[model samples]
Target: MTTRTASARYDGMGRTGKGHITTQSGILTDQYYGFNTRFEDEPGTNPEELIAAAHAACFTMALSFALERAGFRDGTLETKAAVKLEQSDGGFTITRSDLVLDASVPGISPDQFAEIAAGAKANCPVSKLLNAEITLEHHLK
Candidate 1:
């Protein structure tokens, strides 16, 4: 098994607080994020954006491997994930993550492609990690 880590530090409180997030990969080094970034149209990154990126990258890589396993060596899989955060009595909850995929794989039937894509969507690590509802829409070209 492999492990990864990320850290966040917050100073002050609530909407006025400031935060910096850092990841083990160093791709995000003390990146800034807080209420303004998450709830408003402010610059910097939010947890939801990071989650979407992780889901998109993970699902695409999983589909690539699945395609190779199914004898498809050349293809492009592009995915976009949209994560929805909803406010409720319990604060905010991530309600769903919708994946949109654009694929170009020669010599594959739509049915076959859909099957493999569905399998990858169901089995990808990030997909499995998310507790929210997951939906996938694919365009095969």
Candidate 2:
């Protein structure tokens, strides 16, 4: 098995706290994230944004491999994941993740494409990992 790691440090507490995140790959080094960034629309990255990016990438790659296995050699797939964090009676919770896909695959029937896309959405590692509602909408171009 393979594992990836990331670390975060926070100074202070509550809404005024300032946090920095660093990843094992160093793609994000000391990236800022906190109340302002997460809720106040200030500049910087947040956990939801990172999750969306990971979902999008993971779903797209899964779809590509599924297509290849189905005898498709050339295609393009673009996916966008929207993660929603909602406030409830208890506290805040991640409610759902919506995936939108635009694909261009030569010689692929609409039915086949739909089947493959659905399979990918259901089986992608990220999709399986999330404990939230997941929905996928796809279009063939």
| Model 2, span 1-141: residue lDDT tens | 989999999999989999999999999999999999999889999999999999999999999999999999998999999999999998998889999999999999999999999999999999999999999999999
| True-vs-predicted CA distance for residue 17, candidate 2, Å | 0.3
For model 1, residues 1-141, the per-residue Cα lDDT tens digits are 999999999999999999999999999999999999999999999999999999999999999999999999998888999999999997899989999999999999999999999999999999999999999999999
RMSD of each: 0.7, 0.7
Which ranges in model 2 have alpha carbons more than 4 Å from their true place?
Answer: none
The per-model lDDT (C-alpha) reads 0.96, 0.96
- Looking at candidate 1, the ten consecutive residues that score lowest on lDDT are 87-96
| RMSD in Å for model 2 | 0.7
